[model samples]
Target chain A: MKRRLLLVSNSTLHGGGYLQHCQQQIQDFFGKNVKRILFVPYALHDRDAYTKTARDKFKTLGYEVDSVHETPDPVDAVRKAEGIFIGGGNTFRLLKALYDSKLVTEIRKRVLEDGIPYMGSSAGTNVSTISINTTNDMPIVYPPTFAAIGLVPFNINPHFLDADPNSKHMGETREQRIVQYHEELDTPCVLGLREGSMLLVEGNKATLLGSTKARLFQRGKQTTEHDPGSDLSFLLTEAQ
Target chain B: MKRRLLLVSNSTLHGGGYLQHCQQQIQDFFGKNVKRILFVPYALHDRDAYTKTARDKFKTLGYEVDSVHETPDPVDAVRKAEGIFIGGGNTFRLLKALYDSKLVTEIRKRVLEDGIPYMGSSAGTNVSTISINTTNDMPIVYPPTFAAIGLVPFNINPHFLDADPNSKHMGETREQRIVQYHEELDTPCVLGLREGSMLLVEGNKATLLGSTKARLFQRGKQTTEHDPGSDLSFLLTEAQ
Candidate 1:
């Protein structure tokens, strides 16, 4: 239960550069304790390019960062890193890479047992939850399963967009998709993290943070919207 | 391969009733040969209600339909069916149900070996392709794998939408998602079935049908838009 995580709904907000929207939050969360960050860039196609972008951003935020893909042993990279940040891309691809590289358990151990701070955005945030079942991403590639890092107790749906009352699209709305998820699984809770929204978890306490509102959904219960400073401790205590 | 499929992009179009937009294509695909349709209502939660809706719609078009859930042995129902139709809801839920009930092989035999007409919409159309890797639905549940009926040589992306240039959403557009699929997979081809569009496949022949245009994407190639009445027999011959 000693989890310390900074889960972001999106990497870059609209009309902004990469990680520009939440620079101060990210820096404050990591603080001076984390000198270097181990970056996972497997979510995108070009691992080197993705790594360079993340490395540069973290460097700008006053931290030295290296990508796991650059290391000969990824699990070893996780074992020795001071901090970790998995960037946003396709969830399935990211999870598959995690499983393939055997970094899932190592990262879990480092964050929970070793007490290193973990950061994630979009697809990264989706995988840090109990499962990737609520992701807005297409099943472009299927991993071995939908199982992901169980860092937190509840599921996270990042980049969550509300249904537009003016549009007439035939596809299911984001709310309807989460409703269907609740109907299908015994999963206890799912948090809809809108763009520019984020969550900070420290041990037993969970706090909603960012510029937008977050949504809380439970099985067979009405969903409620939460403001930036709302306490989401109920989700951590609920059944998974 | 005697695969006969009427793959629809969506069940309903903007401002249209259930299955109202593509009623004629469905009627022509099944023809007078299929006296009764054995509907797979597993994609939806309320199978009975879903069946009733489909039954009523097909009844108006001069065909009798019964749901697989209403029957005791769903496998037997597929074995003895004149035609089969799987409605849209959640792709993960539908594929998991299909795998759980052991109907994937049965339905494949009926559609391929027996030459019974088959119809699918949205999620249904996704599972009918080589894999459910290109589906637009959220993965609400975990199936055994991404493997599907493989009734066709390529994958189908149902309810496909182009990226709105003016919109400032950071989420991957439908095109970007498909592009990512090509990047991660050796998947030979994927067809983006826009809303109100359909595809008809019969014995080594596949043709674009319905009102809207379809977009085609191949690995490491430029995407091309195809209009209604365009020949897509190339898909049937591509490497899967």
Candidate 2:
């Protein structure tokens, strides 16, 4: 697999500035070779504002951001882009727009085949998996399907939180929700990416980035937590 | 409009027994004419256990519970049911099961025309609305569509929580997610049913029941909060 993905849990940490926590990793990931990156702002409602945020952020990192919404042909823009970054908002809205613009396949090919670096924050990270079934966002809109880019073999649960037993909230916690998913399907495992954390995959070798620990949920298996710099390369390949 | 719905936020409130807080209202809604109430326990994985929980609780309220999952013919169960109660779990799983069993149209017809007393908690309450778009549940499984039973004129955001201003979590607040839904479509409104609360609809009147307040979100209108006993009948009617 010739895939390079920086799947982030959240764009901004609790008290940190926007993408300030993951600045160095993002800069080093895109590097100098990828001078221009295409930005997908469909996850959010205001594309103009989202694009401006990405433009300013990337500008500081020494890269130019060309928003796909501004282009008449998104597929063509994707084909010619050096790198791609999808800012997060609502997962359903983002996936619906991806299907509406017919950019899923093009973007997948660019990342998996052409090896263009792909960075996803929150909802963007959710859509990069086999399905967006594990996302915490409201449906808001119905996509053509829950099927996503499948850039990775498993589903990604971004901004994942553990259950607080003493809490008054009666609704099932994030862990319980993932358990329900496991009850229905067994094939694609789910990775619960904690806040402030991101997963970086460089071809066959994948590593868990950031200070937070990530929990992996595989059917019929005990949930395992991985620390930062731990090898998650096995996630890049599906279990037969 | 012959819709009779008891759409609740959470089945159990903090420090309360299961369905304990809303016991009297549940009994009153069904009344003496209804004997055996069919239970849709498809929301949870263990149908038998879910059915037992529902059966034991309903028995104390003077009703017999027959689970739809236990019946060989689920469609027939809905057709012959005197009253219906949908136990809550994962909203996506419940909706997917409803679509899989070909019960969406049947359930809608039964409730809309037959006017049989219907009760929903959490996920169940979510599907009773115009769509499951406003639900807080994860899409563990993809339903045929986000279009739900449409038992009411608006969408229901079950177990609605107010944003804790002091919290540091970076995910979109409950209020922001509803705002995003409004930005996309202007038709159906959204009703945020807070925990310990439920909406009681009888014929033409829909009242907010319980000790908590409910929030209403309509496009181009100020967000409104209604206290318990306030008439939300307007939500039962689609704005034209």
Report the C-alpha lDDT of model 2 over B49-140, residue by residue, as the tens digit: 99999899999999999999999999999999998999899888899899999888999999999999899999999988888889898888
Q: Which candidate tops lDDT?
A: 2
Interface RMSD of 2: 0.8
Report lDDT (Cα) of residue A24, candidate 2: 94
TM-score of chain A of each: 0.97, 0.98
lDDT of 1 at A62: 97
- Model 1 chain A worst lDDT window (10 residues): A231-240
lDDT of each: 0.90, 0.91
Write the residue-wise lDDT of candidate 1 on A1-240 in tens digits: 778999999999999999999999999899987899999998898999998899888899999988899999998899999889999999999998899998888888999899899999999999898889999987777688788988987899999998889876788999999998888657758899999999999988899999999988989888899999999887887563
Q: Which residue ranges in model 2 land beyond 4 Å of their true spot?
A: none
Q: Write the per-residue lDDT of candidate 2 for residues A46-150, one digit (tens) a residue.
A: 999999998998899899999999999999999999999999999999999999999999999999999999999999999999999899998889899999998
Fnat per candidate, as a fraction, reads 0.85, 0.83
lDDT at B9 for candidate 2? 92
**Which DockQ-derived CAPRI band holds candidate 1?**
high
lDDT of 1 by residue, B46-104 (tens): 99889999999999999999889999999999999999999999988999999999999
